[model samples]
Target chain A: MSNINFKNIKDRQFDAIVIGSGASGGWAAKEFAEKGLKTLVLERGRNVEHVKDYPTTNMYPYEFDHRLETTYTDKQINPIANSCYAYKEDSQHFFVKDHEHPYIQEKEFDWIRGYQVGGKSLLWARQTQRWSEYDFQGPERDGFAVDWPIRYDDIAPWYSYVERFVGISGNRDGLDTLPDGEFLPAFPLNPVEDHFRKSIQTKFKNRYIISARCAHLSKPEPIHIEQGRVQCQNRTLCQRGCPFGGYFSSNASTIPWALKTGNLTLRPHSVVHSIIYDDKAGKAIGVKVIDTESLEELDFFANVIFVNAATLNTNLILLNSKSNRFPNGLGNDNDLLGKYVAFHNYTARITAEYDGLLDYRTDGRNPAGGGYIPNFRNVRKQETDFLRGWAAGFGANRGNVQDRSGVGAELKTSLLDNSKWGNWNVHSHMMAETIPKEGNTVWLDAQKTDKWGVPLLHISIDYASDDWARRDDYYEQMTAMYEAAGFTNIKTSNDPRRPGNDIHEMGGVRMGHDVKTSLLNRWNQLHQCQNVYVTDGACMTSTGTQNPTLTYMALTARAVDHAVKSLKTGTI
Target chain B: MNGNRINRRAALRTMLYIAAGTMVLPACFRESGSKTIGLVNMTINEEQELLLAEVVETLIPSSQTPGAKELLLHLFVLKMVDDCHSPEDQRNFTEGLEGFAAMEDPATGTKFINLSPADRLRFLKQIGDQDNDKITMFYSMTKRRCIQGYMNSKNVMTDLKKYELIPGRYIADFKIG
Candidate 1:
């Protein structure tokens, strides 16, 4: 208690404390605040307000110094960040630069991170799809990781609650592989994409191509307008943070919504060191934090502490939280604090060209990025050499062709020429589900401590053979489908990248029924330590092919509901 | 930074009750002859900037519409090359500009800028023909930055292409034929 400022206990106390202000933590803050509980949210980075802070939101292409291209100096400094497609000059400020915080890579891993108050939610791709029962039963079917303590039915209502507020825009495709959720009007796919949908599904069984579901506002509802967000303007510059609040971000939606309740206190630049566990109480109570500006140490007392510091950092925080009772870490009686890690495989891609749709070209930018083909293989049962199948995005549009040959008015005329439209270029990328393995782990390095005195996280996650096999299956299936649809010049490439490049890493503190094998129980609570919940990506029992943000929000909302009721009944 | 410049320009246009297409250079060029704003990575004199301006203007001449020089795209090219390019490219660009800045006009015994526009174009063509790798490198680099700057110029986006800041509607099946 040497670091605890006891005299200021009244000011430092809270009903609920949330670490990180990204997708899940934002939901935790909103739910607890709406439930009439005073909440404190600790964000380790600067606060970025919605419209006022979106500096490049309305910037035209010409406004960018380098036309939004990554420069040599930028790549030299941000080797990990430059690898991300979203890390451009327009949104570079949102991503964490390598020089900002150093981490050891036992193997090459591109851990794309955004450290602002909104975290990576400010820069997410905004794809929000519901996970199905197949995903929940993945571990049980293939027997890889431990069985998930809860099923899709347990969290389905919470998904509806989250989707209604987050304003998910998706068509209910009546899918058993990818369940439908409460949604607004989905942006319609262009004629070519619809053509592919009609062509592929009629030829293949158990395969469907629906409009890609996203968090954008195709049409704003009353609840959305109440949050000061209007309809999406179709700018497609969402990576720069939409001024319309067209997309759901913590800065635009949850954090502000929680603030309006007057029960939330958001403390920015408060880097959380570790959770403080009480030795005799047999439960967790509060967290130790360091002021990022002055390095002044303090402790925040809370009845319930939710750890939603993304996936890897959550593991880092837990693994560094050594205590007298739990010597290895908090609730480390199982030694599963930083193991069974997995990520989505997104590097494999297939591209082709459609000669038709010559007259009908895509007009506007789709915030949804086009259509989605739900996971077709290993649904209801394992039907492939791989354990799980891949979900893919399908898109087709006309491209602009300008000859940059001659050096005069001919060139200028050619440059501004819009008369010549190229063939309808079609492409699809595989988002395959990777199996979680105990060998793929993230741990705190022994000797390397950061400026905050916390040990640097050592990330050693990699792909298994199933990942490569699944990629091959994706190429094979996509090629056959393209051939069926009369798409020519078809090419497929694996484009081997590191495992964590997908940025959907999960399962360092997975949920399970047994305390010996998992850290969290069914309600996202620590099996040994009550009053603490891990509802973010870290609690995922297995990685599903979906984006994972929507599921994280649903789990956080459900856990808050259960934890709040338990607090009233004195069971937690 | 460049980001702040864009916001300030947008906000200034909104507050000053001016249309967005106004790209006047404050009438300072006639009085001062040649002037520059700032540079972080590379050093350039007023003469060198003037020579670069000539290259951009020659690349895209002004007609009824604003050219690259009128839109101040040359400065953009400078900023991009300075902040965006590698040190080797920057060395070649600066060294290439120096070669043109010091070279005596063969027709008239003056510098390259003193020559007429027709002579300048011919001299540019002569330089283009030379096997000097640095000049060729400089010519191509300037051409690339010039074209990028010209196409993505505010004048081109707002006036020529009509870039919509808020399209509001996404016509999925827009007729293009």
Candidate 2:
């Protein structure tokens, strides 16, 4: 509602500018600032302070007027946003309305996005896992996608760096597919889950189940304690934002550290549209931003520009920054700027009912982070059906007394008593890796534009035959595993949901050895433009089965180091 | 001038209090023993809520621990049905309740509530097992609502389940009584 005023413009230059305040951008800002660089971080959404701004963190269900209800108005108005299970009255304020910033869905792309300071980091599932050698060496092994410029060794140290900072809690299993990492002590598995784990391990030679690797600080280290962070309160209400600062998020961790440095300037409600490329210097000098509130154009100059505006948005900005030298868009001469888009192919689910576990009960208050089965297939030897592998996250617990469905005195009695805890329920969802195909690409929609008049990202993606084949195999494997583990009345279902529905959007400006084929080199610096770097999910060369946020943080930190070193060496 | 300003401020405060009182107070202070009522506080009236409470308690009665009614699961269901559910869901629930209310035993030609506990249980079992539209609706709606409400409540979470803030050790085997 504020009026645009060009007279208020005061151009300021910085050593580096990061175009986002989410997972990667926050890390970039912290790393750059810690390295003595004056960094300017631009966030498209409103500033959200931790604890103070997390409105629903400690509230009970009954306290809310809507209690977890999704209204007909919500579904009718924002169908795309309403499709997700997370879209509820309890947390509706976190999501961006589809009407405000609509994108053309070439297919049915459920582009679940949050545009606040912390972005999707506030709403993420927090299941952290390390990418093993198999993930890094997948493309070359399968002959499907371009080989990564960097390998496991290159990213392993960085993963450790991130894990130590973010405070991941998990049990270390020396599995080849799912590697171990620097982790805080793992959350204990329940008795039923342990039974399943033992059963799976005994039945299958390589297959195993373990507790989920999560970003929750199980026990705060000295570094984390110094940052005023505490251990997890076992409050499952994380998506609302942990008021305890129990989990890793930009609002809770990196940005606060950056602020303490006093060398970082964070500007919220500023959307970076494109990077201003200097043709003669052969470098990106700065970024042109659209003031979200006032609709005014502004430029912030920097020696280095870090494009951490998620995967699709980063590519959209790159493709829109067209100049005389690079008419195809800045550093997009290879026409591979917005190509090789990949997302986790999530198509598997298993549900079952258990009997004779009546007295057993778990604290229904805590979130069921779920148990994980480390990837075993194609680890030691090759498998015929699928080249890569997938991991399964499964959980089981006693059904609540309120599970009594019928009405009347019987229903009432059934609902109240914890005596009938015999009825147990088990659920498992599989995260399968997909090959990064050139055809699975995102392009700027010439027809559609946002409120700021910038072109919208048009995503055109679908799972390949290999992905489908893997999904089918995953279904069979999961059902068999559940059955073998003594789960009764087992049922399996697959939705064949769209790519972005997983909310694990990756690839596009991928890392690769060949400059001609890839947009960025190993360091995530643009092949042609050295001063500009991308360290979001955009730099993902391959889509691994694990959640990608932790990896994004690690890569951003690594990229910051690389950028700083390059600057000193006069590489730009 | 000072007296006038003070009077105006007091008047404004009184107006605000009256407006808020009219809106919220009535819902909180309902007629104490009203049995047959439509809706109150985005849920069934206290009397109907009590009936639902009794019903849920019977379904999952406390042998070892507190039952559904004790956890006020029926109130939870009513709240969910009235406020949380979609408009279509609300319609379905009302229709389902009506159908249930209209049900009569063939032998005596009497309403379901007139039947003995055993007879009621038998009738409910038959209806529930067959997955009859009305019965299924009642069953699923009540069950899901009860569980969701009870599990999220502090009584069930803290007292019944005994939620430990930090369970440091991961024990593979624990006896289930």
Candidate 3:
């Protein structure tokens, strides 16, 4: 308490401290600041202000030095990061380079990362699907992972709350497996896609397809106008960072909203060392940080602290935080800090040509991707050998094929011709779910440390038997569906990309009912230390068959509300 | 505007042959100032650059509208190949360029640079049909870059294609007859 007398100590103290400035951390910042608490968000990377920081947002194809192509050197250097579909010349700056922060891969793992104020939120594909009761009860019903502490009913209102603010555009898809949320209008499916939907509905049993719900301002409400954003312009260049604030990002939405409250202090270039636990206080008091430029260590104190440093990083931070009472890690009682890590499987893809939709072609672009075939297998009962089911992204479009043959004036004429549209092509990629196991783990390396003296992470996660069986099932089912749709030349391929490339890695410090298996409780508060909350992907008990950002935002909002209430009642 | 179109490079090329040093080296032609500007990484000189420009001009010559050369696609090719291409592709291109002019026409027995326009076109078409290793690499790289540059240039995008920066709507069933 003697440090409280120092003038600088007051500047360093806050009502709440959030570890990261990513999707979940941004929500924590906004919610805490809006609730009249002085919030401090610590980001480990450079600050990226909203529209003004998007360097390549408005650039054309020709404006880029190589016509927006990923150069050979770029691919050679960043073999893993450049393998991502979004890692082009325009959006490459947002993605972290390969060797920028090295990690030990016991197995082949491509840890795709973005380190900045917005984090991966700026470069997200923006598919925001609400998890249903099926997802909440999966682990319990199937007897695989630990049961989720909170059910869909407990977090349904939070989903609606986050959806309204985040401006999720989706249809009220009436299904028990994939529940609907508060949404704006959905981006329409092309003719061929709609044809396939009709085909599957008439023929198959439970194959429900709808437009993938996405985080975009389709029709800006008064709240969105207040946030200073407009309707999405269908640019589909979202990885470059939307200049119009058409998409939701930490830089575009939550951070600015938190700053507008005048109670938020965003501290970039603060690499968090660990949570500082006080043995006498019997809880976490503050966080230790290493300045990115200087090697100096500093500490920031707060009454309540939120650890939302993505998923693997949140586990790393907690696993590194050591105290006299708990030397293993903060809130780690039963050695469950960095176990049961899982990621979504995005290996399989099926492409086919639909020649019937010759007269119909697509105009402009779809930022919401296309149609989403929600999890159909093992919804009501476990029909397959796998524990969980998989969702798929389906879209149909024609290419702007040119007859660029011959040399001289003939080539010139063909190159200028934009009227030649090729046959309509359809494609679908699986979002398979992998059951988390003890073998799939991430921990701090014994010897190697980063320049900041933090132990480098060593990841050892691989696909299980269920993952392989699901890939084969996806291939068999998709090929049959394509044949039924009267499509020809159906080609199915499973790209041999390793795990961690999906950017949906989750469940290390997971939330559950029992303290023996989980680190966080129902309210996302640490079991032993109630003041420290982890509401990011780290808090997920099980990975649902959907893009996990929407669930993360909902969980974060719910946890903040619980924290604020607990703070008032002196329970935290 | 017409009189001022010629830059200092053109003026220098037309007027002077400098005695830069008393001890001149054998490769003093590099100081002749005919080399194109602003390209980095790739090792290129004057004659090879002119040969690339002529190849681009031959690929998409001028007619009613601006051609590949008029749109400065040769500069784009050099820039892209220099910065964007692989080291192996760059090496192949450089090696292929050394033997480009010496490719004697089978019918006329004349060098490629000395042949008539029709004969030059036929020679390139014949060379393209054959799977000549280095020459094929050079041709493919040049053609791909030239077409990309020409199709995406401001003139083509604005006047010909009408690429909307913000297309506002996605028509699911747009008709094309």
Candidate 4:
């Protein structure tokens, strides 16, 4: 703390400067501010106040110009961002236009991002699950990529630490692969879903399906309640942002806490382009930033720098930051800064219709009503084909009467009349794990630059043969189980979907033991630069088949602790 | 006077005359064009709007609670179709209005409006159940559009059912069926 004397630059500099205010940046800011460090957090987009800024949260679909769907113009302007169903009129403002920051694709790659204060944390599907030993030790077991510097045991306490604060909602299923966390009560499954769960359990001895572990405050704990958060309203308009602070987001939780500390300084509309690496000092003294609104460049100095600008964006910044000592980029000694990119293989799910459940109806309309089956395939025993395993998230609900359609006077009359009948439907989605391939990477495109005059990322990637094989196996197994449960009109589909459709972008500047192979060390501290630490999805050694936000938060919290300790010990 | 001043004076006179003429136009024209119905805003004129509201109210009348009109279902449907529906669908909707006018009540040998409530319901049911593609498509379209309008209304979401802004605790054992 003495080494970082703000008195010397109280009129100019901060003790720490955190880049990107998404999941990781939010945590870093909160931790640094709480620890009494004068921290400055930079966000590329407009400041979004939790409830007030969520203009569409309380708005009904009928009120929207596109009725919760994307317009033709929106699709045309943002081909990649508009691919996801969530990227619609209701929440499109949260995302950046692809054309605005055009990235060349050597192969097709989807880089879905939200460049706001809360970042993608505002729009993330809050299915928070702990990565087991399998995820941490996958590289070691399969000898695919380098092994993870940290293991599940090392991060277990931090996971608990994050869950306790964020208020995760789940059941205490004592599974090894998908470990349970400090959870609020789990949401109930529909009657049909319960039947399917029981039947699947009986048919498959080792496999299990439990309720989805989400980050919604199902029940406000003492900490959550103290933070002035509320319960879930069951109005599944989460992407639009919850006005009640019912879900976990940087806007709803961390940023507000940091602001309350008064030690935090948040500069919105300021996009950090690169870290100013002082070659003589052998440290990152400050960061170079561009104001998205003003189109003006500025440099801010700080002792410690935390790059939480998501996965790809952080890599882009690091790669763009060129110095005399490190010509390739800062911490690019091995030239592995933006290589071995991995994203979840989403195309793995089986859908089926049930006849008897037509009469059964649930009163409350829950937008997020479903259960998840953890990865139980490759944990205790190994699969002959695939090394890693995947998990399934299934949801069941009664179809609305609005599902019916007609034309002319009859159509008009039927719509006006509410006494209509409809059938119930069940849907499911699977998040499959893909092995890290060195060929898949993100590099800088010299031709393209964003509105802020930063170099655009060139993503070159695709699903490997092993990923396709695993997806095939996933479809076959899921179909067999659904058929066994007596579900009729069963249709199974794999994610013929593109790379970024799942919205879980990982890898690129991954953590590893060997400096020659990876960018960051075990503590998420860059090998070449001691002062700079990246704790976003970029720090992930493996892309496990779970929502990665929770893990990112845990890592960010752990890294902040390490950074603070390192500062005290004169390591930086 | 200058050419621009002469032109401006002529334009102003023409605008005043048109505005005065529109004041005497048929109430339907004035009402239909004026109304702007949607989630955030509700702007509808008098006369037939009340009738439309009444028609929807009768279909889902108040029992223990307020009915469709109170829920602003008609307004919501109108706004959604006007704003949200695809331009092609909007064009189809205009053409479909002709099909609606062609509908006759057998009892009265007149349009649907001339019939009693019971007869109206009977006439609608018969046409609604028809297997013809055109008729079925019309029925399906109207049904879907109306449901979209009604269900998404704030009145329906908040007034009728239990609207939990946030159900803090998720009880897995709760009865979902």
Candidate 5:
């Protein structure tokens, strides 16, 4: 508490300025601070203290106003925000209401955001699957976007580095598509899930179903215990924020570590406007920020700046950074600052009832993560009609079937009967990869502006034709698999069909080998501005069918190491 | 009167009408009762509350276990409809409550609240099995709300659902089938 310097933010210069206190920003703060660099973390939202901020952590279902459902007024205010399953009565405080923060949706994009100090880290689904060699070398082989400068080998060590500190719970399934991570004890697969895994493995030669790799401390290591985080209680109400520090959140993990180092100066309500670029110096010197509360503009100088302000906001900041030398906005030499944006297609799903698995019933309560079937479509080659593949998440459970038709004592007896549990039912959703296109981009709306006087970002991204084709394939294959397993009442749906709802928005300021093609280089540094780095979702060259937070943490750690070495050599 | 004051008064009246309708008076203006009712900031009046209590009690009457009235599920139902349900649904609920209050037994023309237990049961069963959309909707909604309130009550959830705050372990297989 004493270490975090809240006062004198206008005076003291920092060694590094990290924008956005999220997954990548927290890592940037920790890595930079641990390396003896004076780091400044600017969070746009209000300050949310660790355990004190989790108000609904101990609340029961009955304690809520709507029994864990959002109010009608709240739903009306945040129609797009409340669409996500997490946007409910218990965790509504964590979400950014749509009325408060508005953006011009040129194509009706659901930009769900959490603007608190921890940002979306407090609201992220903690599925932590690592990308493999296939994911990194995707663009080069298929010829869609520019090639990723760093391969899987470059990031594997960093993945290990981040995974060791933040405990990942998963088994070492020897599959190259979804590479194994350094794991604690994996959560055990339930009887139905185990049966499905075996059946799937036996049926398909090239596929595997394993427990979803999640950033949960199943068995806390000594380092995790030293940080005061305990093992997961499997309560699964993590969107309320974990008081036990059982799951990996910036509020629980990295930001606290960074604060403990006495080198981090956290300034909440400081919304970054743009980067202050120096033409003669050929680098970025500082960032221009506006205080969210007072609406006062301020500048904080730093030797190096990391734009970890999520995917779209990172592009917004970079695109707004106008200078005399680079008039088209910062390092956007080929006008590629906010181009080739993509998101995971999350509309498609398959559900079925398995009457044979009645003997093998799963427990009612579960940790949020489900069994993950890695992308098996184009692992070796593009055998399918689609270009890329999709990852399917599997979950099976048993529920009570209360008799609703009858009234009186019979209905009460039917509901109260202990043996009224239904047969095992299984379901899975397709997180298909969308191709990054030149047309799908985000640019500043010339007409609209936010309350802070920044131009409202006009998002024009949607699912391409390949994404739709891939969805059909996902539905077909998944239904076939369920049928093979002797399941009945097979159902499939593609409702709420829209991009950006998956919340895995990626690739606006992408990395590439050539300076002409992309904004950022192989090291995630902007090509024109060497001192500036965009290592969040903005650095993704291709949208792989994996949960991207783990990859973002690894990339941020790797980029910070490169930046520190470059600083030592006086490269800037 | 101030414009804001008039608007606020109109809103409150509308809310009360939406909860109790013109047939019933507001709870605060009703006869002072000896029963210790926990006053919640909702539009449901005292008589309406008693009617709901009687109605829900008829649905799940006292046997070996506690009934809806014993669990005070009418209060839960009122709070839920007022705060949680949409304004459209709230209006529908209040209109339905008015209809329920106005309904009389076909045999003896006795008001719903004054009917004998068996006659009340038969009347409710007839209402529940009605072909008319309004009658069916009102009966279905009331039944569902009562069931939800009673089922989620502390006694029901703790005893039947066995909801634990912390399971401590992710056991793959449980003994219950």
Candidate 6:
């Protein structure tokens, strides 16, 4: 709480300014800095140093007081954050408190946000599946919002470029719908999972249940080793942050790499208010930032600005950037700045017991990444009742059953014996693609402002009939699969999950070939403002079934490349 | 300098108690408060500690491995009841302990604590199995906390459960014994 006088903001001018330090921002900063641009990364949260700041990384369950349960105060502070399984006592500090941060929810939107240097990158599930040609051509085929400006070939090499540095681990399952990527050795499936994989492969020609392609380094390459990352140790305590730099995080990988370049300047607790626009110049000159601690306003100039402040906030920032040239907001002339928002439907879960796997069990602690069944229903053509498809994350494991009843020596002996563990059980959850609509949007709340005086984002997004239809299909198909696999006690949960709970929210400032229909172009640059790139989740045109962070990274890197080239060519 | 400093371990312990459903009150508030002194505030005499320890030992006695008292599980129970449980739950548990102390063995005509280990076990078991509200509530609460503390103990988890912190590789398909 020390009050410090503001320095000259003009002195902090850079070639490029990236307003985030999460997945997208990290990559943008790295790419820009490596390309010899003096890049400034503005993170609106406290700096969390790698390994050192991961306080609970090496802690044992027995060492923890509540083992792994959230405190009453934790729930009281941020019930939304507590709703997420990752927001336990072990990693409560990483999540934002609901009381401290306020946003208007026209619909029930469980906006799970992390406010730190690494941001949600540290808290992400690390599932990195590539969007296929079918995904890129989805809107055109189905006649949805607007066609994506770019296709699979546009992002494929860039995906490879990021993957080489990040170190993705998976087997090359050469399926056309779910295209393979450059990978390290894949994690082997358990016997029950293997059985299911073989069964699915034999039964269906369309579906392929392969090991999930994740950011964890299964076998550290020279590039990963150079980044000081090692092989993942199957800890499954990734939410606490990886001390080994096992999985990719801004703190562990990209941000650090960017810093090592000597061309990157990281400014933490710099809450950006708006982009400063020059009407005559017809381009964004700089960004106005509010100091989170002292509430002092500072404006820094930059040649280029990459809006990688996650999805909703990116839209909020751009919508708030008003000027004489763009009264609505910067590059928001057509009122498409904060509309057509979408999030993955994670409401469906199917679970069943496999008594036949009594002889076998999954050994060692399984990490967050698991076996993935690529969407099979409507990959080639829209044959289903619904338009879009959903990807299923499948996992199988055995549970230890301690005797809760009885007492004395017998009970103690029973509990101590690992031989008396329970039978194997398999479970799968659906991550369905959400179709973006005009009604589902995020706009600035005119009434309320935060402590920093920035208007709060009013998010009004929900699932449509298509979402429900997908859930029904998910339940039906998964149940049948489990039944066919000779599993008993099969149960499918169709419990409704509120939007933003999946944390895969995208498409507020989406990219399209048409300038009126979208805010950003194919290269992720604003149509009117070439120097300003919005290459985070904000640039996503469609909410594909895959986890969006990897795509965001690739897009950020790709956008930086395009912007840098434009700067040299004098086009921007 | 110390005033601004936070004891992280103590803070973590407090959070654990809170998560376990125990509500610990501030030390400064003890003077102003009435009828809701936390277990952390209360000073249980040596005799009471010994009695609780003996009771836990009976509940989860040692075989070749360490018993409840050997692992100092009674301290965990005391801490949980004092720091974790709600005020109402604490009162119920306190009253239940008193009630348990009063119950006499028919054959020996001695109070529960005064009875032999074997007789005490039988009496406690019979009380535990009873449908009576007081006996059932007390037994279940005590047993649950006792077991939770014991099972999660460093020694137990390390030796018995064979908890590995760093399993270098995940052997997905292994034959279960």
Question: Which one wins by DockQ: 4 or 5?
Answer: 5
Determine which window of 10 residues in candidate 1 chain A has minimal summed lDDT: A1-10
Q: How far is candidate 1 from the true structure (C-alpha RMSD, Å)?
A: 4.9
Worst window of 10 by summed lDDT in candidate 5 chain A = A1-10
The sequence of per-residue lDDT tens digits that candidate 4 reaches over residues A1-572 is: 21333235453488899998987899999999999998999998889988889988876554564457665455667889988767888898898788876788887777788978899888988889999987888888888878999899999999999999999988898988789899898877777788788998898977887888888877788899777788877777789998878888999999999989988988888888889999889999999988776677778898899999988888899999989988888899898878888888897777778765554566544434687888766776676577787788887665445423332334434434444435446667778888878888888877778767788888888888887777777777888888887877878766567887787778889898978888899999999898999999888778988889999999999999999999889898
lDDT by candidate, in order shown: 0.86, 0.77, 0.86, 0.75, 0.83, 0.83
lDDT of each residue in A1-572, candidate 5, tens digit only: 32444347645478999999998999999999999998999989988878999999998776664567676667777888888878888898998889988988889788989887789999888999899999888888888898889899999999999999989999999888888889997887777777788888899888788998899999999989877799899889899998899999888988989989999988988888899998888889999999887788888999999999999999999989999988878998799989999989998889998876565555645674568899998878879777989998998888777776665677678768767778788899999888899999999977788888888899998777787899899988998888878778999997685677899999999999888999888889998899999999988899899999999999999999999999999985
What are the per-model C-alpha RMSD values against the true structure? 4.9, 6.9, 4.5, 8.3, 6.2, 5.5
**On a 0 to 100 scale, what is the lDDT of residue A229 in model 2?**
86
Which scores better on DockQ, 1 or 2? 1
Clashing pairs in 1: none
Could you give candidate 6's per-residue lDDT for residues A1-572 as a string of tens digits?
A: 12323375556678999999999999999999999998888889999989999999888887776666664445656779888878886898899888878999899998888889999999999999898999999999999979999999999999999999998888898888888888988888788888899887788677788988899898999999999999999888889999999999999999999999988888889999999999788788899999897788888889999998989999999989989888898898899888999889999899999888677777786664569998887888878878988999998888878776766776677767676667677899999998999999999988789999899999899888888899999988888788878888998887566888899899889899978899889999999887899988888899889988889999888889999999899788
Best candidate, TM-score? 3
Each prediction's DockQ against the real complex: 0.45, 0.19, 0.65, 0.12, 0.39, 0.47
Give candidate 5 misplaced runs (Cα > 4 Å).
A1-10, B1-45
Q: What is the lDDT of residue B1 in candidate 4?
A: 34
- Kindly list the per-residue Cα lDDT of model 2 for residues A474-531, writing each as its tens digit: 8888888888878898988986677788888898888888779888898999998978
How many clashes in candidate 6?
4
- The complex in candidate 5 yields a DockQ of 0.39
- Models 1 onward score TM values of 0.91, 0.84, 0.94, 0.82, 0.93, 0.90
How close to the true structure is residue A197 of candidate 2, measured as C-alpha lDDT?
A: 85
- Please list all clashing residue pairs in model 3, or write none if there are none: none
Ranking by DockQ: 3, 6, 1, 5, 2, 4
By DockQ, the better pick of 2 and 3 is: 3
Ranked by TM-score from best down, the candidates are: 3, 5, 1, 6, 2, 4
